[model samples]
Structure formats: structure tokens, C-alpha cells
Target: MATSYDYVIVGAGSAGCVLANRLSSDPGVRVLLIEAGGRDNHLIVQMPAAAPIAARDPRLDWAYVTEPEVFCENRHIIEHRGKVLGGSSSINGMVANRGNPRDYDAWAAEGLPTWSFAHCLPYFKKMETFVGGANEWRGGDGPQSIERCPATHPLYRAFLEAGVEAGYERTEDQNGARHEGFHIAQSFTRKGRRCSSAAAYLHPVSHRANLTVLSRTLTRRIVFDGRRAVGVEAQTGGTISTYEASREVILSAGAINSPQLLLLSGVGSAAQLRSHDIAVVADLPAVGRHLEDHQIVPIQYSTPEGLSLSHRLKGLRRYGIGLRWLLFKSGLGASTMCEAGCFFRSSDRADYADIQHEFYPLTAEMGDPEANFDDGFMFSMGLMRPESRGHVTLKSADPSEHPAIVFNYFAAERDRRIMIDGMRRTREMAAQRAFDGLRRAEIAPGPDIQSDDEIMAWLRSAASTEYHPCSSCRMGVGEDSVTDGEGRVHETEGLRVVDASIMPHNVTANLNAPVVMLAEKLADAIRGKTPLPPSGLVPH
Candidate 1:
């Protein structure tokens, strides 16, 4: 006999964890949360500094590689999505950024009024306990614990000073009154440990009698009864089984898998469904359209011998740092290393900051585990909102097969121009007098590559993702949208997509925080609660 639940949430990820907690809060309702990956109790996941290692681990990450991009020198980019519980939040560089207020206003302009920054600000406040204390913008008491990066390292101080010297303002809080200028980054951590959605929402409520969490279970497809989603068919320990949802089936499987699951379940374009030999369910051509991601290129420079964090990752120092963290949860392992960053416009033509940059005190070659630098610093900058769009489609009918993702980075001439400006701005900031003592020679794109054509060519070969992918299953107020403003799948009942995939567009920052906020807002909508009143606070 198939088990029954009031709500069956696929993918115990950032969004699913929150949804499971919220929906199961009612003692009368039974909730089932299923995850494709194993428990997130590993040391690498708990330590904020181990993010890079966790991102590369197949056991922790989906590690999906995009299809060759026509614009990005026809190279396949690695797209890492968390397979474990808490999803990308567990493996991500825990930067807690809410993005610019206008980002959501753009969504509202797309016919999603409830998604306007004003309407969504209250939910963003509701989901986080900011160390900076409560205000009109920041939340004081919430599930997710947020910490402001100490920004103690001399290199971090230099970066902030350089930003100011290069004509950028310095704000105390990026997620507070203003999201512009340079500031110390906020992190999703508490007392040194990672504060993932699992840690914040699910783990605390796991003992609730109404909630049942199934880890290491792969959801094959949604089990639909006619047009309504009834439940899901899944595999656990090689055994196939069906779990019925009496009320709703929510897909929180990040950007890539959510659309892939929908396509596999026969809810995508009729032509594509027929080609895959699957009977069409809804014939929604927009199921996997409008894919958006943040494309980043690193501007790296050599630093003084002992100034970079990479110097400490060798021999006895590495072991000592690990031992300290294990013993007291303090030291290098306590921080994600991305302690400071800047948000600024590439040109006056952009309304808000079109370029987002984060600085790392150490550098390593991409895909090279052993190429740790003894002296290096890097700034990774990406166009906050790109004109380029891509799509996610099924490669085959097999549920286990990965989907084909094509993030056509630099497809738009405007996107390429903005990236070029961002690179120039990064170089300008690095050349400031603040870094005169610590700065060394350029590493990644050496000083030799000066011309526009040369820079564009270099970007095509070097640009990669900032790991913020969204909008493949976007929410809007039109026939082209897959989900409604409230995240309900169009032309469908008892089903919704409540992850980053539902974002109308990509936010102007790292996605983990915004995805969590999205889940918080949608959970209230799903529960039919009174909508939180819009804060009406605008950034200065």
C-alpha cells in the first residue's frame, strides 16, 4: 500500500526543508520530505570553510555540467547543485545576500505583484536572524542565523578601502538599508557552523510527529491523476514505490531538476513530450524556458607571501587549523573566506548595480585540487542581471539521466559589454593605492590582454557561473509562465514549484539566501495565511 501525506515535498533542499517545516507545523497535517542525497551531517558540510570541497564532492553535489555554449567558446560549464538535504545551501559559499530591492520590483512588473520587493521584504525579514539586529529590513528572531563577516583580515580591509578610493561608497550592511557599494558580507552561519536550511528549519522540527523525511530517495516523477498531481513515484534502496499526497505535491528540486522533473512527468511542450515518447499532461511550452544564471570571471593577482589564506593550507598549518576548528569551532574553518564584496554599476546606464563582486584572499586553479597558491588574491565579478537567457530540456526519457542545460552566457551584446566594464572596474579597484603594499602582478588575465576583442575572447574561455541559476520554471502572470505569483503551476492543481527555479528572474546576488526567502514566502501562501504587509522600504 502506498503511504499517504497531506503534502509531499520533492527534494529536501533549501526550499523543501522550509516548506516541510512550515506545512507540517499544523499537527493535523502529515508531510513527507524526500531527498535524492544522503544525510548532511558530514564535517565538510558543517564547516563553512569546506564549501569548495563540498561543491566538488559528487556525494554532496549534483555537479551538473551545462551543454556547450555557443557564446562561451563552446565550453561546457560546471553547474553544481546540492544533492544533499538543505541542497545548495549545504554546499554553497554561505554568503547571505538578499539582492537589490529593484530585482523583485522587476518581477512585479512582470505581473507578479505579490513578488515586488516591498511585498517580499517582510518574508525576507521573517526568514533570517541577522546579527546586525532588527530594523525595518533586518530580522532579529528567525530560523536562519545570519552573521556579519568580521572582516578582520588586512586583505579584506584593503579591498574595502580600495573600493572607497575607486569612488564607491562603503555601506555597513548590504542587505539592510542599501545594497549598493562595498561592505562586509553576511553569512548563513551561527557560532562558526553552517546554518543551512536543514539546520535552521528541518532539523529542529524533524522530531515532529507530522513530518516524515526520507533521505537518499530519488523521485522519478510526479504521479498525476488526470490534471492534478497526486503524489510521486520514487526509488529508495533500489525499491520502487509510490507516495500519495492527499493535498499538494511541491517540487523544490532547484533550477535544473525541477524543470527536468516536470518535463519527464509530461507537463512540458507537446512536441518535446511526443519526441520522448511520453504522453503530454499539460503541454506547457514555457516549462523549461527563460533560464538565467550569473556568469562570472575572476580577476586574480599575486599577493605578499603571507597575506593570502592559501599559504595556511599547507603541511602542519592545515592540520593545526582543522584541529582548532574541531576542538572549538573557531579559526580559519569558521569563515567561508568570501568575507567582503562590492556591488556597483558598470555604467550610469544601469538603474541599479549591474555588477556584483566578491573578493577571496586565496586563489586556486579551477578544477585543480592541488594548485593552492602561497600568495594570491582574487575578485570574481559577474553581471548582476544578464540579458542572455538559456533553457533546460530533457536529454532522454530516463529519469536518472541528467537534463541538458544551456546557459548561453554572453549571448547578448549588452551582457558582454557589461562584463567587460566589470572587469575594467575590478582592475581599477585593485590598482588603488590601498593595495600598493600587498598587490603583486596580475595572474588570471595578465596585463598583456588589453584590447576589447582580446578581453572578450578571454571571457569566452574563462567566464564561469557564480552558481546562481534560476527562472527555468519561473513564476509570472501570463500564459508563458509555468507557475503563478503564488508558485502554483499554471493549469494544474495541488502542485507547485517553490525553489530558485520559480524566480521570475535571477536576483543580483548569490542565490542561496533569496531561494530560502522564496520558500518562506511561498509557505505562507500555501498555508493560506494572511499575506505579510509590504514594508515599503526603498534602498537609499
Candidate 2:
């Protein structure tokens, strides 16, 4: 492998894969994509239903647990980052969400006009080939193929119907015009297989002579010469290799690792760097200051035994599901059982939909085959725009050691208030007459937990991450930001961040789509391509 390239992108994640594909398109320039984990060829990664299995397997998942969260009863919440080529996008629930348009418009309101909904729609369209076909708002032809969930299960129908009965409209396309309603899920799937970022972007262009992908190579730190990033020190099979980049070094290691990398490279607070006996490269105090993530509290309801999908997992039927998927890629195994969900406001005073919901057919932790669970469905509800902030700090000077992540969830009063309201809103939707026959007793946070105080207490123990962490290395106009609107590190040259880590704040939906969109847009700027004109289409 060549020891130097024009562009060296760390972490072959959702963002990095896109960068590798787009940047390598110019044969004149060479690109090297480094992945800390091995290849994402496991059956657990290909089959969509095996998402949970892939998330906890040490071979594929980082399985980084956070520092005990004080807001959630001091529970050490699990943070499952995909250790494979596609990163979290490989193991995450394949929900293809772009969040609300207002999310980007708000970014524009913050003085980064290029990130407004109008400016971002083109890139969102550029990265995705919506299975439903394209329009003014949705993209027609793109790399990532997105398909809508069939949501044919009786229970799925009931949940969606319940939302309508609770006075919400059934939205056909959540990613289009308006998203504030109950909708069938859009999955990052091609045919029946999971269309991971690696599968969609990197694998398709593997034959490119200019592109070199190095797997199982853990990047130690950025090698900088007087504030300009030159390359990175990486370890491959106990062999330390240095790869120099003549153009730029991009860090797409997601929210946690990116911040951790910055801190380890002496690019964070000078005091913090000195504590680890590391020399300061730049005193960017905000490197890991605005850690944000969505915390969902599950509201589970027991369904009749035969009505639940959990019943099929008992014996031979379970094996059949796997066999069917392996043979023809059709069946329940072809999809991440998370079919139905919605985006809605907690109350009238709220801005665009402030809360989000995702319904899963089974409540069991599929990761543990030995652990038994009841036959039930759960609605994981969370605040779309969470205000709570936290930080990612190095545990030690050791490069191999995982960073200490603290979500500080619900630290903001508004976050706490919205969560309780969102929980109540979830209950109201579930209680609709549509669920009368299919749904049985309330399984979790039962009838007794009705009052605000009871719900608040229950939330302290129940709420956990939705696996969408962002904003540890935010891009903005102010000093609080680590990067600029162009994704270049504030004071550092030739170093850029193009992932969810650079989000000014977390988007209103899942991070994968937003991260991919971020890369697609920034890749143009990096190549000196003129920015796409902002769209004028208005959301209804």
C-alpha cells in the first residue's frame, strides 16, 4: 500500500465511506480510507434482522459503555458503535430519516446559511435514491437506496391506526414536504439486504486504483507540524504505519471517537492535555464540550401471545426465518423489525414536531438468546431536538483506551419537561381504540404510573440512548464550535471533520442520513466544486 495519499480519511464510517467514494472519483488524486475495525462481511451485518446481534457482538461492535449517567439513576448506559467498515450505520436500526427541515433552517438561522434546509436538500437528494421515486423534495437517483417499510403486521397497523385515532395524520413520505405525523418507516435497504454506508459507497468503488481501504488499522493520533495536520499514526496488526496526506486529513470517527481523537492529539483544552502529560497543539476548549444524543424511554404493551412476532422466535420457526432470508432474501428476517414510527409535537406550544417515536414489534433483547422476555411491542419515544449536553474526555493517555462519555441526559429543564410530555403523548396514542383488541395489559410503567411525578421517576430509570450521538465537534460560526461551516477545524489547517460529530447540534431524526448528507455536501467544497443552489420548495 502507498504510504501517502492526497486525502486520508480516518474511520470508514457513514461519513468516511462517502468521502472515499466521492474524493477518489478524481483519478488524479489518491485517497486512503482507514477503518479501525475489520471488514463488514458478517452475516449478522448483511441480514437486516440481525442488527441487534451485530450491535453486541465483540467482533463487529465497539460496545463502549458510558460513564454512569447521573440523570438516569447512575446507570452505565451501553453505547454500541459498529466497529466494522460502515461504523454505526452498519449495526444501527436501518431507519432512513433526514430529520425536520426546520433543523437545517435553524442551522441557517445560526449564521451557517449553507446548511439550511434549502441548501441541504440537494445533498440529501444526492446521497439517496428514494425507493418511492423522486420529486422536487425527494431525490430520484442517488447511491443509497431507501425503501419504505411494508408495515403489514396487524400490530403495526394497529399502532399506526392508533396514531390517526389520536388525531395524527398518516404520512406517506416522512422525508418529504412535512414530517409531523405517523408514518411507515423508510429503511436503508436495497431489496432485502441492509444497504450499509460501506455497501452503498465504498464497496461499489473498491476497484478504483486511486482508492485504498485499510481495515483493522487503528489510528493513534493526527501527526501535525506546527498546527497543520500532515498525516496520522496508525497501528495495523501490531505494526505502526505512518500515512502522509498532501491535501487534507478528515476525521469521520463519529461523535465519540472524533472528540476523543482531538483530545488525544492535544487539540483540546490546554489544561486537559497537560493532565495527560501531552503537549498542547491547540487550546480548542469546545472540542468535546457539546456532546448530544437522543434518549428514548420505552413504553411497552403486552399483545396477545399469537399476535406478537416474539411467538415465532420460540423454535423451528425462528430457524426457518433465517433460512428463508439466506435463500431468497425475503421474510421477516429481511427487515429490522422496527417498522412503524412517527414524529409529533408534545403540545401545541411546541415548534415543529419536538418528539419522535419508533415502534418495534418485539420487546426482547435479541442480543441475549438465553434471556427470556414477554410477548409485547414497544414505542421508543424521544425528544427530536434535545438540549441536554455532555462531554467526551480521554480516560488516560493510552490511545487504545476508549473515551469516557457522559451524556448528562435531561440536564436542561426544557429537556426534562418535554420528555414527560412526550411520554404522556405516547401513552395517549397507545390507548386509542385501535389497540383495544390487539393490545393486552400495559407491560411497563403500568396504569399506576399516570401522574407527572410518577412518570418522571419512571423516566429516570427507563430512558436510554437511541444510539444517535452527535455534536462533540460541532461546526458553527462561534468559538464554541470546533469546525467552520466548511467542516475545517477552527484554527487547524488541512484537518476537517465530516461526520455527525461536526453537527452544530443533533438533527431532529436519526444521525446516519444527516451524516451522509453532511459528507455529500462537504465533499463538493473539498473538491472546489461550486455549492448547489439552495432550493425554494416550501414544506406544507
Candidate 3:
């Protein structure tokens, strides 16, 4: 790698990889993409069903455990962020969900006109090549390839039928026009292999002479000239090095690290920086505030021994599935085992869907291999728009220290009420007649647990993160917002943060797909190009 480039992007995650591809598309621009982890070309990373293992594997995932959450019985949730090339996309459940369009409209409602769903739709379309074929609502030609999951299993059918039996509509497309209802999920998969951001964007053009990727390098801090970001100081295998940016310093290191890096670089709250002995460059008090994440409560049930995905993962079948994927890229190994999910309102009082459900055909944790004999299915739901907010702050000035995270989950009364409703609603749906053929008994909060108080008690003991953490460096025009709509760090020159960290709020679904869309939109803004015209149709 050279001493300098047009764009020096820190963190080759979902957003950085996209920026590397898009920014480097211009042959004249020299782009440098640096990652703190090694290459993503692993068999475990490629197989779809192995996502759980991939996400928990220390080699790829930055397995961060949060500070004690008082609201959830003081339990510390384990959070996973991608450390490898594609970042979380490489290790996440490859569900291709765009969330509700209303999510973006809410951002526009909060003074970010350019971030409205109407304005963001074009970019979303521009990033994905959905195999279902694109229309006004989907994309046909794009970098990330998405395919509909083959929800052919009887359990999948039961779940879809159960949702309908529970009185919700059976929408054909969850990512398209209808965002509310039960449906088969679409995934970022191409002919059975996981299609991550690196797989889709970076590797394809990595050979270009103007583009350089420095993996296994941790960016310690951003080098600044007064208040302007000029370059990045990083460490590779204990040897410190610096790389300059001729045009800009882009940070797509994700929600946790983006803000953490800003603070470490002397750009956060002055008081916090002073305590750490770091000279404050820009006193952006809201730098690490407003952290948002989804707190999911799983409701599980017993199913026929051979019906659940667990049955396919144990004994000889596991090896057979792996061999099939290794050979023809098909079978259970080709699936994420998260074939179906649902979106619906928790109550009639709510204006939109407040709860999102992920249907998993297994009772065991996604990562544990020994528990494959546990034959059961489950569905998990989280309040889409939570009221509680949290932050990321430094434990010390040391660059190697992982920042302390306080999710403060379920701190608001509304958050608790909605989640209670979500739990009951999930149980109600699973109890429908369509589930009769598969459902044997309720495994969690069993048949005895009834009433609001009982459900709330159970939730406190079981709530866990859906792995969607964002908005720590949210974009807006208020003190709570850390950046502008263009992802430009407020009051900083030649510096930008393009990733989930800049989301105004957590969307109603998985983060990886929307994170890709966010990068696609901001990449144009950074290049100073005219914004894409709004579609002007509000379907959601």
C-alpha cells in the first residue's frame, strides 16, 4: 500500500467495502480499504446454514458482551460484529430484509428530508439484484444477489399458515410492497453460497491497481489537522503505521467502533476525552450517544422429531449436508435455517407493525452443534422502534480497549408494554390450528405462564439482542445526532461515517441489507453527485 490515497476508508465492513468498490470505480481515484481482521474466504463463512457458527467464531466475529442491562434482570447480552472483510454481513443470518419504508419517512420527519423513503428507495434498488426479479419495488441489476428462501419444509408451511390462521394477511413478498404479514424470507445467497458485501462489492474489483486493501490492520485513531481529519494511524501485527488521505477519511467501522474511534481520536465529549488524557479536537457531546438495538424474546415450541431443522443437522445427516454443499452447493447447508419470518402490529392501537418475527426451525441456539438433537421450532420478536437509548464510551484512552456499551434495553414503559404484547401475539400465532400438525407443546413460558405480569417476568429472564445495533452516530440536525444526512460528521471537514452507525433509528428488520442500501446512498452524496429522484409513492 502507498503512503496516501484519495479515500482512506477505515473498517472494511459492509459500508467500507461498498465505498471501496464505488469510490474506486473511478479509475482516477485511489482508494484504501483497511480491515482489522483477515480474509473472509473460509468454508464456514461461505456455507449459508453455518451462519451461527460463523457469527460466533472468534476468527470472524468481534464477540462483544455489553455492560449489565438493569432492565433485563441485569443480564449482559453478547453482541457480535464482523471482524473480517465483509464485516457482519459475512457472519450474519443472511436475511434480505429492507425494513419498512416508514422507517426512512420517520427520519425525514425529523428534519432529514434527503433520507426519506422516497429518496432512499432508488439507492436501495441500486444495491441488490433480487433473483425474484425487480419491478417498481425491487432491484434486478446490482452487486448483492438475493434469492427467495425455499421454505418447502412442512414446518415453514405451518408457520405461514399459522400466521394467516391468526388473522394476519399472507403477503407474498416481505421486502416488497407489503411490509406487514407472514411470508417466506429472502436471503443474500447466490446459488447456495453466502453473498456478503465483500463477496458482492470488494473482491470483484480488488485487483484494480488503484484499490488497496489492508487486512489485519486495526486503525488506532484518525490523524487530524486542527479539527479536520487528515489521515489514519493504524497498527498491523504490533507495528504502527500511518496512511494519509488526499480527499477524505471515511469511517464505516460500524456503530460501536465508529463512535469509539471518534472519541479515541479526540473528537467526542470534551470531559470524557480529558479524563482519558486525550486532547479534545471537536467537542461533539453526542458522538457516542443514542445507541439503538433490537431486544428479541424467543418463543419456542416442541415439534415432531424429524420436522425441525435440528433433525437435519445431527448424526450422519450433518456430514451429508456439508458434503452436498461442498459438492453441489445445495441441501440444508444451502439455507440459513431461517426460512420464514413475519411482521405485524402488536395491537390495533399501533399505526404500523411494531413487532418483527424470525421463524427458526430449531429449538437449539444457532451456533451449538451438539444440541442438534433438540427437535423443536421457534420464533423470536423484538419491538421495532424502541424508546430507550444507550451509548458507547471509552473505558480508557488505550486504543486496544473495547469501549463500554450500555444498551439500557427496555428502559421505557412503552418498550416493555410492546414487548409483552409481542410475546403474547407470538404465542397466539403459534397456537393457531395450522400449527397443529407440527406443534406439540410450548417449550418456553410454557402453558402455565399467562397474563401480562407473568409474560413480563419471563421476558426479563430471556430477552436477548437480535444482533441489530445501530444509530450510535445517528444522522440528523439535533444535539443527539452525530452526523448530517450525507454522513458528514457534524463540524468536521473531510471526514464521514457511512454505516449502520449513522442510521437515524433502527429499522424494523435485519441490519445488513439496509446497511448496504445506506452505503449505496451515501457513496453518491460523498462524490457530490445529484441525489436520486424520489419515487414519490408511499406503499408502506
Candidate 4:
């Protein structure tokens, strides 16, 4: 007899892990969580500052690079995604910002019912257990734990001081009422160890009799029975297997792979599918469209003597940090790859606060090479609200084939304008009197690099993704929308998408928290239950 499940959730990532835990809580429904990666119990993943190290380990990461672009000319930007059980959570900077309230309201205004800021705030509360505790708007007793950075680097003080001098206030909570200030980023860590979604949602339930987490199992495609999704075909080792979903199949395979899987399973554009010899399962042209990502221009600065993580870090200091992590679970090791962040509307913009800057008191390349040193207090600036749209297309008919991703970043005039605004704000913040004492020579887009054209050209050549890709299978009520507002595949009987792919648009902050909230809301929507209450607290 084929082993069947009441619910089959593909991709044991942020959303999938949450779904696995929440859905299986009933015990009546047998859930199957399929992961393409392995266990996330590794020490490097547990150590917060060690995230950069874990990102380089092949066992924990799916290191992907974008295809060279005519716009990029020569630079091939690398896109990193976690391949382990925790998914990107194991590799992410761990800064947990739920995004601006306006971003969600904007989605609701765009025809996605119940996706308004009011509707989402509750789910955001329900998915988190904040360490500072919570108010009516925030949850104090959720499965996923959230905490403030325990130890602050000396350079962090410099960055925060700089922001204040630049006229930015020190906001108590970036996740609360006011997001327009400088603050120490709250991380998804507990007692110095990473509290990845897998650690919070999947690990505890992996031993459940009602749930089976299949790691190292690569999903090939969604098996169909005419109009409905009946099962998933995947490969484990050299064996090809099909697992039936008695109730439904949820694709938590993320934005990139979710749409790729849909296209491979013949659910994309008619012209494209036919050319690839894939029989059309659905004529959804938007299966892989409207992709958007935050483009970051890392502003690295040299610290004023003995103040940088780079300076405080060396020889026995490295040994001491390692030992402290292994023993007390407290020290420099207990920190995210990035520490503080600030969000603001550029003085240059009349529109919404469409630019965000992240303060990293440590220096390292965005990805890989554990031994490579690029240390210092480096703040990265990103365009928060982008109007650019892109697409994902399968290169071939084979399910194993990688899809072609074209971000088309700065492809639109509005997008380029936003990048320009972001760069200006970055400079304004860096040039503040607070940083004047510690400021060093410009490492990127130097002083000579001024003017809108020069900035845009630099952006096109130097700016790279923050690794947040979304909206391939965007949610909307329109026919062009791949999924409905409730996250259901249009006209489909028993399949839904509950990952970043379902986002109507990218959130103003990191998408991780919003992704978790979406899954929580989806679980409630599926079970016909009301979501939790919100944290009444506002940013101080």
C-alpha cells in the first residue's frame, strides 16, 4: 500500500516547518514534511555569529548564482539559500523585522482580501514569542522565539550614534509602531543559539508519530489527477517515489523553486510549456512573474581604533569566543551576522519611506569563504519598495532542470529612481557628524562618485540582491494572479502555496517574519479558526 498523508507539505523551510508543526498538532491529520536537505542540528547553525560559517558549508546551503546579465555586464551575483532542514533560517542574519504596516495594507488594497495590515498583525503576533515579552499586539507564548542581541559590539555604538547624529532617533522596537529609526535588530536567537524555524517548529515534532519529515528527499514535481493535486513525485537516493496526499499538497518550496516546480509540472504559460514539451496542467501565465528583491549597496567603514568586531576578533579572542559559545552560550558568538538597522523615508523622496539601511558591526562578504576576511562595521542600504518585475522560466522540460531567473532589476524607471534615493540616504547617514570622528575613505562608489546618473550606473554595476526573492506565484484575485488571496491555487481543488511565492509584494523589511506569519494565517484559514491577538505595543 502506498503511504498516504492527510497533508503533504513540500520544502521543510520557514513556512513548511511552521505548517508541519501547526497542522500536525491535531494528531488526527497525518502530515508529511518533505525536505531537500538534511538535519539542522549542526553546531555552526546553532552559533549565532557562526551564520557566515554555516552559509559556506555545502551541507547547510544551496549556494546559487544568478546568470550574468547585460545590465550587470560582468559581475555574477551569488544568491544564497539554505539547503538544510532549517532552510535559509539556518543561514540568514536572524534579524526578525515584520516589515512596515503600510506594506500589508497596500497588498489588501491591491485586491487581496483580508491581507490588510489589520488582518496580518495578529498572525505576526501568533508566530513569535518575543523575549522582551509582548503586549496585546505581540505574542509572549508562541513556538518561535525572538530575542534582542545580547552583546553589542563597540562599532554598533558608533553606528547607532551616527544614525542619531544624522537626525534618526533610537527606536525601541523596529517591529512595533514606529519603524523609522535606528535600533538594535531583534534576532531569532535564544540564549546565544540560533532559533531557526526548524529549531523552533520542526525539531520538536520530528519524532511525532503523526508526522514524517523526509530529509534529503528532492521533490521532482506535483503529481496530478486531472484538475487536482493528488501527490508529489520525489527522489530519495537513486529511487524515485510518489507520495499521495489524501487531503492536499502545499508548496512551501519558496518563490524560486515553487514556481519552477509549477512550470516543470506543466502549470505555466502555454507557449512556454508547449515549447518545453510539457503538457499544460494549468494556463497560468503568472506562475513565474512579478519577481522582486531588495538590492543592497553595502557601505563598509573603518572603525576608530579597537572598536570593530574585526579588531576585537583575533587569535585567542577567536578561541575564547568559540569556547564561550560552547560553554556559557554567551559572547560575541551570540550575535547575528548583522546587528542594528534603520528605516527611513529619504529626504530626497516625496513618496513613502521606500528605503532601508541595515547596520552590520562586522565585516564579511555576503556569502562563503570562512577564512576570507572583509571585517569592519559595514552598513548596507536597500530600496525597500521596488516597482520592478521579472520572471522565472524553465530552461528545459525536465523536472530536474534549473529554471532561468531574470530579475530585470532597475529595468523600470521607478526602480532606478528608488536605487538612487537609497544611495543618497546611505551617503547622508554615513556623512553624519557622529561618524565624522570614525569615518574612513570611501570603499565603494567613492567621493568622486556623485550625481544621479553616476549613482544609478554604480547601482547597476555594484548593487546585488539581499537574497530576498518573491512573488513568482503571487497572490491576488485577478486571473493573472497564480494564487487566490487565501493562498489557494486558482481553480485548483486541493493545493495551496504558503511561502514567499504567495506574497502579493515584497514587505518593507526582511521577508522571513512575514513568511512565518503567512503560514500561521494559512493554517488558521485552513482550520477555520481565528488568528491570535496583536501586540498593542508601539515603537518607543
TM-score of each: 0.98, 0.98, 0.98, 0.95
What local distance difference test score does each model get? 0.90, 0.89, 0.89, 0.81
Q: How would you encode candidate 4's per-residue C-alpha lDDT over 131-235 as one tens digit per residue?
A: 888875577988899988743555677678877887777888888777678888889988788999998998888788899989998899899999799989999
Task: Give lDDT tens digits, candidate 1, residues 446-483.
Answer: 99998888889999988888888999999987767899
Q: Which candidate has the top score in lDDT?
A: 1
Q: Candidate 1, which segments miss by more than 4 Å at Cα? A: 366-374
The window of 10 residues in a row where model 3 has the poorest summed lDDT is 364-373
- lDDT of candidate 3 at residue 474, scale 0 to 100: 91
Residue 237 miss distance in model 3 (angstroms): 0.5
What TM-score does candidate 3 reach? 0.98
Query: Which ranges in model 4 have alpha carbons more than 4 Å from their true place?
Result: 367-371, 531-540
Clashes of each: 0, 0, 0, 8
Clashing pairs in 1: none
Off by over 4 Å in 2: 365-373
Q: Tell me model 2's lDDT, rounded to 2 decimals.
A: 0.89
Evaluated against the true structure, the overall lDDT of model 3 is 0.89
